[model samples]
Target: MSANAEDKLVIMNEEELKRKQREKLKKLQATGGNPRPARTLFLFNLKNPFRKACTSIVEWKTFKIIILLTIFANCIALAVFLPMPEEDSNNTNINLESLEYIFLIIFTLECFLKIVAYGLVFHEGAYLRNCWNILDFVIVFMGLFTFALDTINKIAGVPPPAPAVAARVTSQPDPAVRRKRRPIPLIPSVREADSEV
Candidate 1:
């Protein structure tokens, strides 16, 4: 083809590339994602051991399984801790406060592990930016708040100190009667009153 046609062809290719870029930007905006995703380093970096281990196939599988188990455990704990209806009439079998605590610990650890793997910025819809991550964070925060409230309630519910016992009052014998019965001696018996006998 002639040089002019070749130049036209090259311009058309450039236009096509620009069009694709524009579409990409639009798509990113629509999805609430950054068109130009930010890059971060440190623990989340590819070379970091945390990121490496987390992303590894075997490790990821184990991590996922553990997370799933924790969720299941949480369900069981929830069922156990839920108050029974009046109709059920004291049929509750288990007290799951301890289980719930275990679930919270496991859930918290899972979230922390994910954050450690994905980095804290959560830019590009990763880490804290992801919906799942946000939900986990909120849940953990609420759990902490609930724990605080529980502690406060426990402290407040404690019985107040018992009131002091009342002291009994007795009538004293008449001083005149005692003096008459003792009879005053001219010399003080054994005990001297100062120097004057």
Candidate 2:
């Protein structure tokens, strides 16, 4: 084709691209600038108040730094409590457990906010799209599962299983172990174990 014709075609394409970009920017601004993603499993309308709030919060550097600090705090709490000798008072253990729950709740909120800001798995830039975010999602859900299991056992008045028993239950099942499993009591005979025994 002639050079003049090619130049005209190129100019038209560039103008069209620029116009599309401008339209996108206007739509974004109309929807609170940082609206929820499209094609989400749970719908958050463009005008959802939380959609913008969460997007802004998730994108904020200070919010990320705060989450990082909380994770570090959680690690320190685990380090301090996990290695405590058996002789440590029940109060100390309870305090540590409570602190752990608080940390878990904070992490859960972070996850929820991110899922709101980005979509879950369907949309571009979704939560599960990032490797780090997938890892975070798994960790948070596992922590939540553990919390629910503990709460259920407590409500059922089932004594916490022995460490070895708990380990066996979680690991690959052994036929021999299953055969020897005893029925868990609805109410433990003793509220506190005889640590001396």
| Local distance difference test, candidate 1 | 0.64
Q: In lDDT terms, how accurate is model 2? A: 0.81
lDDT for position 46 in model 2: 49
What stretches of model 1 exceed 4 Å from their correct place? Answer: 1-59, 80-94, 152-197
Q: In model 1, which range of ten residues has the least summed lDDT?
A: 161-170
TM-score of 2: 0.62
Tens-digit lDDT string for candidate 1 (59-162): 47777898888888777766665454332323344446555677788777776666655556644545677777788899998998888887887889964332
- Model 2 Cα lDDT, one tens digit per residue, 49-168: 778688889899999999999989988887777443333346766888889889889999999999887879887678999999999999999999998999999999998756664555
Instruction: Give the alpha-carbon lDDT of every model.
Output: 0.64, 0.81
Model 2: residues >4 Å from true position, as ranges? 1-36, 84-92, 164-197
